[model samples]
Target: MSRALALVFTASFGAMWSFYLLLSVVPRYATSHGAGGIGAGGMTGALMGATVAAELAVPRLVGRFGYRSVLAVGLVLLGLPALALRAATSLPAIAGICVIRGMGLAVLFVAGSALVPAIAPPARRAAALGVYGLVVGVPAVIALPLGLWLAERVGYAIVFVLAGGAALGGLAALPGVPTRTRAHAGAEAGRGVVAALRSPALAWPSAVFSLSAMAAGAVVTFLPLAVARGSGGLAASALFAQAASTAGARWWAGHHGDRHGSAGLLLPAVLLAAVGLSALTLVGRPIAVVLGMLVLGAGFGVAQNASLALMFEHAPPRDYDAVSAVWNIAYDTGLALGGAGFGVLAARTGYPAAFGVAGALVAAALVPAWRDRAWLRPVPDAPHCPRGYR
Candidate 1:
């Protein structure tokens, strides 16, 4: 990796850690601050749904403004909500801030992902993205456990303030990167959002990305609660195990994807994830819960990195903004739906049934993996340009 990639990866680390910290704590914070069980979960789901809506709108924002400008705007937007969380005394106010925060997150992720393919060499794109995922994943693994710990030691308000400051730090790194505005100018002029949506390459990966994201969404929203039930107590240990396994898997798979093609890793990744989910059904002991979480996290890391790399591989360079937007929208929408639906289902049938259902859906993802070998053909002799123009 070059210095530029290292900087981007560092920025990603700050941004993701902040984002994950807030996501991990907000539900408990909401409940403690006044909102109850279902309402707290609902607010979390609303945050995710709002992000899906924001992702749908981000491409236009990036087109009109450049990527760096859009990134700056997202950072500002993200920071405000983190600060606002300190003052949110009611459910309605908290929900509103969640929406604002979600929009900011959506813009930041789409812009950042668009920048990744542009910066990486054609042959190294998957590997580069894998590293990017690993950087982001590390914080994700630690964020929840750390947040829970911080909330216990300090307060949620202080946690939000720290998270906001870290996000601002990520914004500070933006100015150092070389710009790609000139290269994207022609594509910006020629394409409309409708034309971008009509492309099969965009739609297919978006669908697959959405499906893969559902499992992760369920874990983020409900896994802690599930662990609590299985253990007859809540343990921070489960969060640590899940995060550690996920970060390790993401780093390993990213390097693997770079050495071998992403297609080579897809089937096994999904299969492992499905197996992990199935294991949840039989987890009656504390050790079993931790083992199940590790399996689940590893599977999610592989699927997430592989799927995103496949999308970039198949997409045209000029379409990076549109592709990132559409793919993220699919992912966020699935996340929201999975979180909300599983929350309700857990209330009805129980965690085991909910985990089983999510597992079944994940298992079905293999159908696409089998067909992806044909679907995601390698890019042929494409010119490598640092400016991101094809």
Candidate 2:
């Protein structure tokens, strides 16, 4: 990573760390305040709902305020509000905090992502993105479980301050990144998400990415419950493996993607994640569970890097903000939808059957992945650039 990109990655890590630290903690916090399991789940739902809403609007916000300004405001919103949680322990107040913080999450990701295409070295952009994914994905591996562990021993208030501070601390890194908005000749005209969706090249990658994320949602949400008894601690180990594998595979995907078109990686990744999710139906086998998540994570990582790289490649330099917003929207929304829907299906069909169904759903995404293979072929012409560049 370049020094500038490293700073952005650090900021990304800090922001995501705060987000994941509270990911599981908030649910239990709600239950302590007399909320049932359903209420705990509702808190997460509310947070995601707010996050998606904010992500859609952030492109416009960045256009006006610049990345540094909007990102600073987002960091403050994400970090500062947690300090107030001690004063207002009511469920309503808690939910309100989540809403405000959710907007901050939206801004951080969109701004951070837009920065990637601009600052990354052109030839090794995929590898740079792999580095980006690794740093950012660390929170999911560490903070998620650690937050709950710390909350039990010390107290939620301490955890809240630390989490908030992690985000706020990132302000030091912000000054290093360029805040200048883009000035591509046609950038303004093609500025919105709607315009991005109208382009098949941009839209299809997001569509396929959402499908891979659906299984990721189910795995992270249900794996522990699915293997409660016999799997030894391998289930948790598997999760760690999954996170680590995803981080590593992202780098590898980028390396190979640069050599052999990124779009070619999509179908193979779908196949891998599908197999892993299918194996998850064998809930009793420790090895299967471990290997399953490992493979699934690898595929998910590949999908993450490939789809994002493809989006940046096909879209003009001008549309990076819309591209970032759309990608982040797809990322969070898919993960949320996957978890929510899988829970319902699992209730009716049981974990094994539900997991199998999830696998089938991912496999079905292969159809779209296959169609998008055209992305591997050389472009007939580059619309955004001149003839010499094409």
- Candidate number of the best TM-score: 1
Best by lDDT: 2
Model 2: what TM-score? 0.87
Error of 2 at 108 (Å): 1.3
Clashing pairs in 2: none
Candidate 2 ranges beyond 4 A from true positions: 28-41, 83-94, 151-158, 181-189, 229-235, 368-390
Roughly what TM-score does model 1 have, to 2 decimal places?
0.88
Q: Please, what are the lDDT tens digits per residue for candidate 1 over residues 179-290? A: 5544485634524445766765556556665665666667666665566544323445666777777777776776666666565555666667667766667545677667
The C-alpha lDDT values of all candidates are 0.71, 0.77
lDDT of 2 at 5: 79
Q: Candidate 1: where are CA atoms >4 Å away?
A: 33-37, 185-197, 229-235, 282-284, 365-373, 379-390
Positional deviation of 147 in candidate 1, in angstroms? 0.6
Give the per-residue lDDT of model 2 (tens digit) for 1-390: 577778888888889889878876776687679865345545666676677789999888877777888888989989998777767678898889888888899999888988877777566666677778878778877776566667777989988998899999988899987776454334454469878877777777887887777788677656655676554255457767787778788878777766776777876886888898998888777788888888998999998988888787777777888998888888777776765677677878988998898899889867855765665454526553212123
Q: For candidate 2, give the lDDT.
A: 0.77
